[model samples]
Target chain A: MDRSVLSIIKCFGTELYNALKDAQDDISEIRIRKEKSVVVYKQNIPYAVTKQGLTALELDNAKNEYITVSEALIKDAFAQLCSYSVYRFQNDINNGFITVNGGHRIGICGTYVGENGIMRSVRDITSLNIRIAREYKGCSRKLADIAGCEGGILICGVPSTGKTTMLRDISRLFSTEKMLKVSVVDERGELSAYSHTSNGFDLGLCDIYCGYPKQKAVICAVRTMSPDFIVCDELTGEDIESVCFTVNYGVKMIASVHCDSLENGLKNVSLFRLLKTGAFNKVVFLNRSIIGKIDAVYNIGDIQKLYE
Target chain B: MNNMKIIGAVLIILTSWLTGIMLSKRLSQREELLIELKQLLSEIKRRITYEMPTMCDLISNCGTQYLKPFTDNMYNSLSGGYTINESVISAVADTPLLCVLQDCEKQLITDVLSSLGAADSTSVREITDSAIIQLDHYIGLAQENRQKNSKVYFVTSLYIGFAAVILMI
Candidate 1:
């Protein structure tokens, strides 16, 4: 790819990431104007292609239009795409978010019902944004030097810090170049949003287990999948303890965690426990600009050495 | 002589009127009580018809090998040990029949505690105490259910008896 094309691609990714991070409600549509073509993604799936300008639907109007997009159309689109439907778009006012096969994520927004500090589910889902997954060909090249022949690495950053994007790229690189068997525990369909036999990105030799609760999925994957490397995002609670225990079985893990800074990452009780267990061989910290710039990467072992 | 006769007539009228008011008020209070009792009895009957089977199942399951093994297996499966305690507590607390069954379980536990060595007695007592707490909760729930049902039955019978008396008259 030309350097200018690469620059434009980076810019597009940066802009989209920012928009997603700042999003207060569901993002109805994402329009990317490439040099050659204009691609419009609706409910995280690309819906239309045109050379001319298109009006992206506002949150409320988008929901209304989505209701009109018949269940038959949705089902057909999903079937043609080979993605299993996790949820259905019922009303523009309720039951809106849908999870398809292969870890592709779509955001749903409407009135919410919260009980006992748990989101039981969503209601009155007026808007849905289906985010298409695409793998950058050489996105992991920047961190290849730090990866150092693969042991276990932890990727830590705040929300929308390109952690999932980075993990997807690394998984792709590992599958394609290293020819390693990668098992992805995608709790939410983000990393490998492959649906209906078509993957948002080309993940070579990867077996993905999607929609399982994170810790349970990890344990199940470790037992049955027998992956060369297990990759997951957003570790929490006892998940760190489980990860520590799994390391004893000699399975390499690559996971991303949410944290603002390296100090905060260390201070996290779960993260601290995982570190103390000597499970993680490396930790990579991500820094991004307001426009999603790749600011810096740090070695976890190096940070530990400084602390010691 | 005229004044004395007027006073006597006034006294008689006052007595009769007071008696009538007292009788009417007593009857109204009885009617209210009967209505409340009837409501409570119907509620109890409904609960017995609908919720009793599930409660029976829960009680039977609490002591069965199937439930015990299932609980144990779930406990072992999860990484956390506290899961087992939580599950056991939840199962015991949620079952409607637990109030009655808990006392029986407690007696058994107490006997075991007495037979055990002195060192083991402390641990046994702790377990018994927890179980007793759960039992008490069930007992309270059961009493509430009984009160609701009994009241309904009492009111219904009272109304039927009153109707029969009226028909006889």
Candidate 2:
């Protein structure tokens, strides 16, 4: 079994785990909503696996057909993801996701507990979406070549659109084949797939700064690791500033953002500012239906024109 | 007939000495456990202050002897989605090393572990730091007790065993 799948199985209660293990190849996500049917995401669709190892087309097929996710099971699975210590994962839980070993991302949903506009912890968790991470080696090779092989590249896609997977492979490629020193700012441990207990993805020759936010990681990676390129996943708050800081120091970067269209991507105020600052050379957009297929590639010229 | 009596007398003496050794071993173990716990808490404090290491990393790297069972139990149970406190409580309860400890010592260890992995960073730091300080007193008491009690146990065991033999004779 893949290490990611193994983690899921270990978190799953015995009966559900056995059923999923019987048909592991067809599985992608294991979604558990409190007191609701356990819906396993497979083939880009959700299916309910029965106790007899039979798969139903939909969760609403029949009450007895789907696995019933228990509150205890959800709590147990959440604890496992946190490594049995919520204190360790408090920040990540506040952010509503925990990256497990092998780069799998567990999207958490729970009662937000915090103090004065800050998310301190997640309590009374109601649902968990375990998203399995897949690596497609050489998937971004053509896109990288098209987007200009030497400078900055940003992969843009919606959730589950292979943004992180592409970054992981690209980091692996550049660091291994080209012999470039790549630093991965794995704020969420997604890109490097670094689990606390075991390493998830192997980004050969890349120095990863796990758990550090983008703003700090970019500066630290450039100053300490002296990488030729820094790869990261997701451009969120304060990320543009970090990327700009790296650009000023003459270090290249490969990162991703959440968006689908070329226009919307560049038109994003922060991203537009980042493009204008010459932080990224190209924005490579991906279609979730086609995995790594580059639906559009917008160069600096195209991106700059958006501001015009 | 003389040789049999001589052999019996030697056997009784040997048994008394063995009993003394066994009696003293518990006192020494209690002392050692306190020292080890102090060290473990210090290590945890250092790790948290400098780096955010996983509980598994902390336990696996530092876990030794009697603490090994606790770490092992916790490591296995954590993967099963059990809470840190619940797993650790079970681990401590199940560990043979802890079974030899006094009730107060066991309670101290439990309180220390309860807050170890499942709290906020600030709280974890505070707990570990306080544990290190409190464990120093425990270590000192255990050391002093070991010094006084080990000899006491050994002498008492030796005399008791030998006196029984003498009384029988």
Candidate 3:
């Protein structure tokens, strides 16, 4: 077995042990099959396994709930598997999960722990999925011109609507092709695929302030990095107002958000609020078909016109 | 010449020679000790002030730069995507100041260490005590600044309650 691969497995095992220790008494046996995968079973029930070794989920009739392995747990395991990665569980336990590096994502699912209308932590989390995000070259070819234009563009789509993908591609275009000084406030590391102090995706000649709060990172980028354009993923929260206020700095913004339709995108209270501030000039809606095709782009103003 | 007179003359000459040699040795030793002390004190001061700060700057930059993306990701997850503007603004607001403070702390430590070096054993103990006092002062200042900043954020959020409502809507 390669030393590096073994080391990775060992790390994974340690992370799994830590995460599950509170729940499980002991990780009885860990078996690595074909030098590519590891399966961890407690008393031979197969509680969790790596993706490389994942097969069909076996049902345990005794357990009332479905016994399938969870994505969140797997993601946490994978993060531990990688040597250079850092894993942080956001203190906001209610809706928070774990963030690995700036690339891989593992969303948490469980009971919400709320405090006075704010989510504090997630309890009884059953599973987690680890998605490895990659940046493909030329992904932004279609959107380059629109993104590179002088004004800012807002990308709108529903949940799992590839909004982040489009934003990533646009950032690449602005940084690499247009030769613009781009600063990516990658709050989730989703947009830039930044991992291990090196970017998993080619952001061209861009500066990324990773791991800071998105609002702070964007402000910092504008003031210090001297970026001509700022790109960020998943714009939400009271910070949008600050973005509006800071537009006089002359740095343009490109960001993504979740909404179902063009009208929905514009009518979204947060989106509408941001729009009213005149912070963005263009809004593009992304539609993905059932067969996984990027269907169309709609202007927010046009949608509003139709609504009127 | 009488025996007693001769003996007295010899004693006087011997006493004078002994006294002169002793004085010369004492003065030379004192000069050497001063030179050694000065050289050590300067070297210590430079290490504390210049080299220490440089090392700290490197560490802070490396740590902040390394941690920034990770922390940003956490912030994003917590804020539920509404954190973009705040992300940039906070980064701008906090990092340079942190770098400056780190430099200041390094210089402070160096100053204390340099002072301690020139001190004798007893004085060294006294200097060490003084250095600890100085460190406590700076640490307190840092904590106070942090508290003040935290308060500012709290107040700002309170004032921006309307904006927050708009965002949630």
Candidate 4:
């Protein structure tokens, strides 16, 4: 077993830890809220952990199968996670989460402490959401045939649609085999494949700018790395300006954005304007229902369906 | 043979007197050591707040030579897979001076070390302040004892040795 899993298991008692281990492969997230039954997720399906293992979603009933997280457990886990120095991670906690050693992000939910429109701290944390990081190698292989030659590709999908995973594999494929100059702007250290063991990390000749904001990292990666391709996970409104900058620099870029429908994605005025300027050639929509299947491929400028 | 016997008796009395003085000397040293430790805690708190160095770095640089063992114990425990809180608490709780320290003093040191590096600026200040106050109280007591009872131990030891010699005679 990976040490990361064991580290996470330390937060749970013996029984819950064993149950989680049995279903570790299927788990995408483990939610531990105060006085609530532990919620486990496989893809998008929620399951309350039973004594034996994961059973069907049974939240309302306070049964023996369910485990309620205690304040003491959270304290122990947080202290261990911060290496027993909470001061070191105060800023991270104020931001509502801290990414652990294995790139697993533990989102903190607590009362916010702020002054003058700036967040000062978070106190009395009551819930934690642990998002387990996993790499599905070759998940982006299908996009290679179509959007391979496109200048800038944007993968659109809702949450849990595997967009980030797909982007990670594509970077792997491009850098390892083809030996393309690849720079990844891994803002949260999520997409760099840094969390994986030796077997999982085949980033192969790619440069990763981890934990930098998307805009700054993208520009820095372009100027310093001088890569043929730059991969960034998740695009937002603030990213439009830098994406345009990368486009002008003639560096092919791949980024993911959260939007279920292509129409909704293009509805953003800045994104539409950028698309109209011929910045991106292809926008691939991922259908969560199909799980990694492309819903449609729209060619920019023409706004024509290239292929479905 | 009489002169040699006299010399031996004088040597025996001198050893007893010095042993009594040693106790007083140790108490004074302990008082000084506690003061130095409070200053070191101040240094650590300052560094943690502004410099924000790693725990290992903080431990190494927080103390003078006198406090090296305290910091060293923590640093070594960190490598031995103990949490910072646990390691620090163990060092103080298993103190070499546990036999000498009051129960409250031992508890204060342990509590401070356990929570020192794991709090925000405000809370860290509170922890250090509390520890320093406790140390100050102990230091005052040590100084008082050094003044009031140093002569008592010396005189008591001399008198006892003289009586023992008289009885023999």
* lDDT of model 1 at position A230: 84
Q: What's the TM-score of chain A alone for every prediction?
A: 0.63, 0.92, 0.68, 0.89
Regions more than 4 Å wrong, model 3 = A1-88, A92-95, A111-124, A146-148, A290-293, B1-169
Give per-residue CA lDDT, model 4, range B1-169, as digits (tens): 8888687778778877788777767777677777777787778778887866556667867744447767777777865767777887777755575445667766777778778656766677788887888788888988898888878887988887676666655
Which residue pairs show backbone clashes in model 4?
A: none
Each prediction's DockQ against the real complex: 0.01, 0.49, 0.02, 0.43
User: Number of the top candidate by TM-score?
Assistant: 2
DockQ of 2: 0.49
**lDDT leader:** 2
Q: After superposition, how far is residue A214 of candidate 1 from its true place, in Å?
A: 2.7
Better structure of 1 and 4 per lDDT: 4
Docking class of 3: incorrect
- Give per-residue CA lDDT, model 1, range B22-122, as digits (tens): 54444444334323323322332333333322222322333243334333433332223222234345444553423334355434333422221111223
Tens digits of per-residue lDDT for model 1, A1-308: 22212222232334333333333232233333222122344334343322222335344443233213333333333222211111112221123344444343445554675568744445333434444344556666676566654587777776555677778877877777888878888766667765443455566678787656667877887888777788888877668766875687777888888777777767777777766666567777776433123455556577678567
Count of residue pairs whose backbone atoms collide, per candidate: 25, 1, 43, 0
Q: Report fnat for all candidates as fractions from 0 to 1.
A: 0.00, 0.69, 0.00, 0.54
Candidate 3 residue-wise lDDT, A234-256, digit = tens: 77857675577458787778877
lDDT of 2 at B24: 81
TM-score of 1: 0.44
lDDT score of residue A61 within candidate 2: 64
Error of 1 at A203 (Å): 1.4
Q: Report candidate 4's fraction of native contacts.
A: 0.54
